[model samples]
Target: MNIVFVMIPIAILFVIIAGVVFFWAIRSEQFEDLDRQGSNILFDEDLPAHQPNKHTDHDPQP
Candidate 1:
């Protein structure tokens, strides 16, 4: 079909754009520390449940 001529160029342009974005991500350090970022959410840096609250549940009359 004549439409193939149009679609082939569009597909090539998409591939080129994807490659550029991939390279940019690599150069910008976007792929680094992927595991650490995921693990940060899994592990709690500070445990508020174990820490005592500054204010008590009941307040004394002023």
Candidate 2:
């Protein structure tokens, strides 16, 4: 029917636009290092633990 004629071109246009955006992302390196960002929060830097001050160190026995 008349609706089919309108719908077909709209669908084709949508596909073309999606393809262009996908290619643009690839060329721009948008997908590079995807895992690094996702896992960055999971692990922390291997910093040395803070030690207690000698003056504040206390041993108590009653």
Candidate 3:
């Protein structure tokens, strides 16, 4: 019975904090581009690795 007094206020505080954060996120447009990040992985460009010069036969050796 004594724990209820403490737990109730804590729970209410947590709920209020969560609501504030949720509203802030909506106002900041945090969820506007939800699919852009996921789709970018599929369409990203991959760069080729660097290769050493292969025409060394005609050049003088060091």
CA-lDDT, candidates in order: 0.88, 0.90, 0.91
Give a tens-digit lDDT track for model 1, residues 1-62. Answer: 99999999999999999999999999999998789988888896675676545686555689
Better of 1 and 3 by TM-score: 3
- What's each prediction's clash count? 0, 0, 0
| Candidate 3 residue spans exceeding 4 A from truth | 46-62
> After best superposition, candidate 1 residue 25: deviation in angstroms?
0.2
lDDT of 3: 0.91
Instruction: Please give, for residues 1-62, the per-residue lDDT of candidate 3 as tens digits.
Output: 99999999999999999999999999999999999999999887895666657785356779
**Positional deviation of 16 in candidate 1, in angstroms?**
0.4
Model 2 C-alpha lDDT per residue in residues 1-62, reported as the tens digit of each score:
99999999999999999999999999999999899988987886776688777678656657
Question: Which ranges in model 2 have alpha carbons more than 4 Å from their true place?
Answer: 43-62
Predicted model with the maximum TM-score: 3
* Angstrom error at residue 44, model 1: 5.2
Models 1 onward score TM values of: 0.66, 0.63, 0.66
